[model samples]
Target: MFGAHLDGVSAGPGINDNGSGSATLLENALVLAQRNPTMTKRVRFAWWTDEEQGLNGSDFYVRSLSATQKSYIKGYYNFDMVASTNGGYFINRITSTTAAPLKAYWDSLNLQPEENVEGQGRSDDYSFQQAGIPTSGYAMGAGARKTTAQATKWGGTANSSYDPCYHRACDTTSNINATGLNRSADGVAYAIWNLAVAATPVPDDFSMAVSPASGSVQQGQSTTTTVSTAITNGSAQSVALSATGAPSGVTVTFTPASVQSGQSSTATLSVGSTATPGTYQITIVGTGVVTRTTTYTLTVTGTGGCNGGQLIVNGGFENGTSPWTGTTGAIGSPAGQTPHSGTRFAWLSGNGSSSTETLNQTVTIPAGCTSVTLRYWLHIDTAETTQVTQYDKFTVKVNNTVLTTLSNLNAAAGYVERSLNLGSYAGQQITLTFTGTEDYSLQTSFVLDDVTIQAG
Candidate 1:
């Protein structure tokens, strides 16, 4: 879904404020209709109204979606004020998957775009984001002043507002930046075509494949493998290499930590005399604009002995929330909420009003642990009457990356066992977090208990 606000402030023509975005969308739509290309995914364009009045149109549209309808929407992209006279190119959530194509399009033109911090939570995209839909967007600028560095890169006077005529009577068609408009329009088309209308298979920006996928070494020995990358699509980009899951007394290094696409690097794994003896799965991660990972199995034989065990401390919440950190009163035994086991559990966000609560703990997984798994039991109860709308949400994240999300739509009567593989982070310290959010009207409780991170 692509969206832009059509309404403007009543103070002036508001040409540059939104006319630029509206024009860009209109032109793109016309071109798409003319071509009538085969589409891999459906494309929907929306011109919102009453946006200047606190994004009411977009918010209402998102709130009206049923759980099934929301699931069908892959992402949302917003374009607003893209042709400010002195505008600096900005892409919202530039590192997100939904924004990759937008950033790539700008990169292809040798233009470095910055994140659109000036417009955060001020546009229609924020409405979608609050509803758990992935969102990204493009913006030139608004009333914010451009810095000297921005002027040097984007060619405009320093200390000047991106649009001098912003919200004024002078903000007529003359306020538009021709060059910015042309460039931005092309980018919008590029993104729409690549995301929805492309008929050919979309190649990954790059690939990461290790030569020796598995190896065996004794304590005090070493092994080597080659990490190779190729530019499957677009121009070459720099990829940084790192390895994880090495046990204690083991060191993993790359000859050159970073490599350009279509290049290769050597990874060395050295084991010390005190290294633990076990079978380990080492994950090699290549990070660029996007991240790619591959696994290498290593078997270590040594005289030292150790047995796998649970890595998390006080996971069951019976000892209180010592190692865990979160909102006050979030971890405790509560009436009407049964714990999966023990006398306590984490109960987050049962308030029938707007509220947010979180619980997180950091733990290190020792080396030499073979099969690592995180397990928990979850129970959800909601006071929401609707069966289709997801009025409340629960999320689980590892190292700040989302692993799973649940909502009022997933409410059930009893506890359900959940398990996730943690082999990739076997020898790493990671933070696990559970966050719950409730809307203004409904109360939903996300209950968790019997949490454990076990390694064998």
Candidate 2:
């Protein structure tokens, strides 16, 4: 605020001069009071009516407060001659004042909010600072000497301040600096946020985090990291773990990948020996107020040799068909019996009889295979004109775990193959079974063959 002015202040009623700041102070006070409990900090706003005629309103306020009441105040800010500025504004901590902290804060942001040219013109900050209180705030200024130093550093005319409507009837509502008002509003917002958090009323959850969290790391090394989020009132609703801000050649993999609610998750960060050594920052983005950042320290000092083995499984399929007699019959072979062209085919003669039972082969996973993929194939064709029943749906199982619970081999050229994730059952004996029985017309026949599993 620059200063408070009076309407026809010099000639008559002193309402317009100080009325604006008073109205503002009253509105601000009422709003703050209403939201006081919800506010993270306490806010104080006051109105000094009739600041004109000689700063009488302000003087009276000072004289009216008790010593103890005044002592509770952190600082006091004044708004005298605010609406009266034609020259740029200036603030005096006191005529010969020094408010370095407040000035420095303004200087850091490169704003020409106020000048100390006269050092002591007028305002509330003056009385407060004189009482050993630190004061700071922004004001709409009048046309003042915008120093080459302030201008070069802050940018504008090194010779002109902000406003040019100081103390004149030309100082209508239209003469006010909207830019100054907007900027002051923004400053107020920042002050409110900072104060609300600093008041110890409510914690600033913006800085919330995930702890025992991941650290930085270099490329090519495998490291485990734990993440825990400390929340106030609202624990992180859900934290998603991801790799980022790390050096090249570094890669990370997670166990659960994401944690929901207060749940915890561990991730495995791997950097290849080829990885570049450097610090890596891991970020967890979520509904949390703050974007929590944790790092996985990576020293890519060594090459990487750690990784999972290839998943492979060598297993046969079980169909009631004749045992895979390396003895080739006129019909086809067994199911799951082939590799990387990765297909399996089975053919059956049907013996011209309506075989009501499934023709199958027993798939025995040997200890030699790391993992296994089982495929079942069969072709059913009836030569007789009489209607026949097609047993097209079948079940595929890995040992007792049902990999393919049910599959409908509904094609005229009946064929179905399912890929199963069997990495967990490496080197373990497993079995694949396809169970389904079909009724065929007299002379109807089918073929089953090609059950295969590739090993690591």
Quote the lDDT for 347 in model 1. 91
Best by lDDT: 1
Q: What is the TM-score of each predicted model, taking all chains together?
A: 0.39, 0.31
Q: What local lDDT score does residue 388 receive in model 2, on the 0 to 100 scale?
A: 39
Off by over 4 Å in 2: 1-41, 79-108, 112-115, 119-121, 129-133, 143-162, 199-456
What is the per-residue lDDT of model 1 for residues 1-456, given as tens digits with 9 covering 90 to 100?
Answer: 566452232112222233223344334444654553556788887877777889999999999999888888898988888778889999999999999988877776666999999989998998999989898887889899999999999789899998888888988877887666666666776777778875543444788899898777777889999989988765678899998898898888998999998899999999888776666888999998778888887766553322345667778889978888887387888897988888898898889899999888898866655667889889999999888988999988899898888999999999998988887876688998889999998799999888888764
lDDT of 2 by residue, 1-456 (tens): 112222322222222223222233323433544442235435666555654455466567666767786666654444333332333334445222323433333343445455444434355455555555556544544445556765565345656644445555566667654333433343344344334433333422323244445443333347776655454433345556666665566666766776664566666667676654333455544344445655544434322211222222222323322553321343224352332223333443334443432433343333433334444444445444433334433445555455653322233454445456554654464545444333443443334445544332
Q: Among these predicted structures, which one has the highest TM-score? A: 1
Q: After the best TM-score superposition of candidate 2, give how far the Cα of residue 50 lies from its true spot, in angstroms.
A: 2.9
